[model samples]
Target chain A: MIEGRYFYPHATRFVAARASAASGMLRVEALDGSLLNEAPAKSLRLSPALGRLPARLSLGDGSHFESDDRAGIESLRRELKLRAPGGLLHRIERSWRGITLAVLATAALSYGFVAFGVPFIARKLAEATPPSIAVAMSRQTMQILDGRALAPSALKPKDRARLEALFRKVSAHEPRGAGGYTLLMRRGPGVGANAFALPDGSVVVTDALYALAKNDEEIEGVLAHEMSHVNHAHGLQRVYQASMIPAAIALLTGDVSQVSQMATVLPGILVQSAYSRNFEQQADDDAAAILRAMGAKPSRLGDLLLRLEEVHCHKGGCAPSWLGSHPETAARVERLRQETGK
Target chain B: MSGEHEAAVESGAARSYPFQFEGTGGEYFGIWIVNLALTVVTLGIYSAWATVRTRRYFRGNMVLAGHAFDYHASPVRILIGRAIAFVLLLGYNISLNFSPYALLVWIPAFLIAVPWLIVSSLRFNARNTSYRNVRFNFTGTLGGAAKAYIFWPLIAMLSGGFLMPLARRVRDYYHINNHSFGGRPFETEFTGWQIYSRFLIAFAMWIALMVAFFTFIAVSAKFMPHGKAVSPNDIAIMAPLILMIAFLEIGFIVVGIATMAMIYNLALGHTVLDGRHRLRCRLNPLVLAWVVITNTLLTLATLGLFYPWAQVRYTRYFLGRMALEATSDLDEFTSEAFGTQSAVGEEIAGFFDLGIGL
Candidate 1:
């Protein structure tokens, strides 16, 4: 038997309701003992139980009974053989053992997703993005950078043309044979000694970087690295990866308010950094392969990288931007030496 | 037994009823952890369902005048709304990828849409919440929302923030005045100037903190030796003092507690439901700040596993102090079926990091 308060939809009052196996029905009685409702046991629906809150059982006529009598609810269910499919969720929610197992499972799954799943998915998505979208993204970035931090090339006309020819030679030897690749020579005093690839296959070689290289082969090495970044769509992948941060944060906090502020700030930070250590290594490996195809020693790029690091690392502390965002130069040079059989 | 209680309430016998929240930290903690586990297990696909279940638990646990409040949103509806919001977000990202100039158009367009979005969100939420099975309703106009959300904030900004109190008043009035339960409107009688009077305490606290900070700096400069070179003894003596000053500076921000508490107290104190029911909020700023700071520390220490406890403790502290003075019998209010509302604008506003007006 079960007893609880019943609320009819049309009235703002409570009626007494009772159900019994002997009667094989549920009935509601008004305050003055008049019959308010009577329905067969099969005509009622039960809301899923959540915590210690009252359980609500609704009849066909829109009136519902709310009760916290756990024993009575269980008995009623057993009498009717009500096979609640949500028994699994209810069991897991009610027991300490199930909750402990869930917590551990969730922890392991989240760690795996963050450590391995997200990067792999980002890489695949980047690879699948249309080349035209990548190119447009790169062009827009270059225009914005030019307006802010870049100027016309400060090197002599002959020097600029010579490097341009070297860029053309490298592009020709590519598997796609100069597939929409453009090389721009520009002075970037603020971003000293840097080479970067835009998503659209445009590589910018700063005057400071060109001057920093000891020989044409060294400059060729840097060009090869930049080309690899463009070909692999690293920039686009980085942006896409940043877009997932809020989702990850939401999972961690389980609160909507906590992840809201990250939507605006996370994208800016991701775009400024080149990418992860794995991305940097891939670019380096590609640069070495390109140098080998050209019959030039791949060690030249490593030598240039070491020199650049030494120049930037004045007084034993490297620039914050250099050491923080990018991988260690010493490690990359060591890897390059191994590839070159040095 | 139920009939006798109903009669006592109808005889114009007044009572000072304290709102009740029966949710315990341990009970809610289980629900919270389970919700989180399932949300992660489903790769966020089940978050909409999780949201509904969480809302239902909290609302169902709250009892007023012998009846519990209820939330009637469907998980499928919320999922569809969230999907729409995510698609819009992707479109915004694509625009950013296309060109920086898209920002020129996007910012203004986003601002213009804020009022309409606020209205939609309020309508969606109010239409879904029910007490005694009668759905609450909101009828504020988009134009009124625009004036409250945009124009007043702009005027406040233009006036060097002196008119911020007025902006808050405008927003509060818009929220309270438009709310109704079964066709009876909520009435708020407080004015902008009244809010400003309460705001003066916060403003004064800010000025005093600034003066004290500068004074401390001046005193330190007078006593300390010049130049960057300092002895180890000097460093040891100054470090603790500097740390203490930093702590004091953070403590000064507790004025935020004062400001927020005063706003809620004043606003709710003047708001009348059905022109008969009265609300009283008696929150103490120091106590509130203590709860906030300790809860934050505890949640951080446990790496957010303790969040459910912290949330429950905070809610119970705040709601426990609130009371409703019943002038008429609450049992007389009958339930009327209302049309369903889509959760799209609520989810979209949530995506944009805007608070849902309560």
Candidate 2:
């Protein structure tokens, strides 16, 4: 028997009581063994076990019985052949060995999800995004760039036309062919000697990169890389990838305000993590294939990368970065050149 | 203890009962990690149950007078609420990226929904809590909530923030005054100028901190030798100034906490139940800040495994300072609450991170 207090239906006042389920019925009695009420064991409900607190059992008439006997409740449920609610979870919570294993499993699962699951999910999301949404998003990006980082093209008309011919040749070699992509030339003093693509198949080629390229093949190599970015929708993919980690963190932490500190670390992690390297590698591989399809050497793209690296690293310091970093450049260059052997 | 019970019965008045927290860090750590692991394995589908179990653990461990409090929210209801909230949140995040018109639609919709969310969430949480079988209740209306949460803040900003503390006072008043237990209202009364004074002091500390910073910079520049490397003598002069500035920065944060504690104390201190029994709070700002900062740092260092310990420590220390001055043996009450409130409002409010905690 468990000694506790019994409350009448919806009443606050309670009396000293002894509770038992030994007779296949939940029985409560005054201390002298006088019956207060009795019900079938299957008809009663037990609250979940929480720490070392008293367990509450409801008698379905709004009357409840409370006792600090977890083991009694466990045995009572067992004898009645009744399933205890939250039984497994509470056992896991109460065991040290179970907790340790849980911590290990949590760590492994989180790392696996963030490292592989997020990228795969990001790819699916990018592919599923509607073209109109992509167009609108790209328009906003171009507007922001124009307001801050981009200006009118300063290339001579002759240089621009020759570059247009190279672009057309690369576009023809792409799976979507000529109409699938478009190119724009602009002077970006801030972004100096750089090229990038938006989600809507618009590739921006800064004029300084034109001045930097030694030959048409080198420029075509750069176009091929940017076109690959367009074909795979990598820009949109990065946006989705960046948001996934914070979303997952919020979900696991109950999306509460107390975890705002974790949110602040997202921008730094998203901008500088290995996910960017994977995107760059994907685009590079595709660009190498496009180069080989155009009957040109893939190493021409590597040559431009090294040339761009010289301009950047010489100005400041030679620290490898997200793109064309000193050490990563050697690996990327060797990979692209190996495409030639195939 | 028997003699003391007889004495309490004889007087039937003016006795104080200190709130006690009996939970230990070691036990809570086990429960918290297990909860988190299950939540993750289910991809957050089990988080509603986790939240319920965690809250129940803390509530059942809190002792008031002689009886422990209890939380009785159903996890299945909370799960349904969260699923709906998740869909809405996902929609909001996606539309925010895909459509520029989203803000124009979302802002007004959210603003209109704020009062309902606050009222529903407060009522739901209050009705789930019980002491001695008598559940607490909230009877505040949406109009009252809007006046407190939206109207007061906007008016405060229009007054150029000189009246922001008054806005806080109104909000605390709205929260405390509308709550009832056993159908008797709880009331809190405090003047706006009292909170304003607290804000003024914190602001003064901030200004003093900036002045000290500028003074340190000037002193450092004055002691530096012209057009030459700084010597050890110069270093000694700069080091004391650096130390002073570091102290001032810490003081700035402590002063902010002091302001928070003042408001906290003022709100709880003036609160009364049944027009006789009074609630009192005496949180030390220095201790509060120490616990808060150390908890944050430790939680970060341990990658969140220290969370349960941090929570236990805070509850044990802070609740020890809370007390109820009773008028009787604390037994003459009846449960008056059984309203079935949907949990969606609270789930949505959590999605917005409204921080409506009391």
Top lDDT prediction, candidate number: 2
Scanning candidate 1 chain B in windows of ten residues, the lowest lDDT window is B337-346
**Count of backbone clashes, every candidate in sequence:** 1, 0
What C-alpha lDDT do the candidate models reach, one value each? 0.73, 0.77
Candidate 1 is scored at a TM of: 0.81
What is model 2's C-alpha RMSD? Answer: 6.4
Worst 10 residues of 2 chain B by lDDT: B339-348
| Candidate 2 clashing pairs, residues 3+ apart or interchain | none
Name the regions of candidate 2 deviating beyond 4 angstroms: A25-43, A76-82, A189-193, A208-218, A242-244, A255-272, A292-342, B1-13, B99-101, B158-160, B208-259, B333-358
Report the lDDT tens digits of candidate 2 across residue range B1-358. Answer: 7588547536855778899999999889888888888888898887787878877888899998778988877666667666655565666666676556677888787777778768876877787777776667787888999899999999999999888998999899899999877566799997767777878877887788788778878887886668875543344754776588768766776776677777888899888887767788999877987876677667777877787888899889778989988764466533322221211121222232222222
lDDT accuracy of residue A336 in candidate 1: 86
Worst 10 residues of 1 chain A by lDDT: A257-266
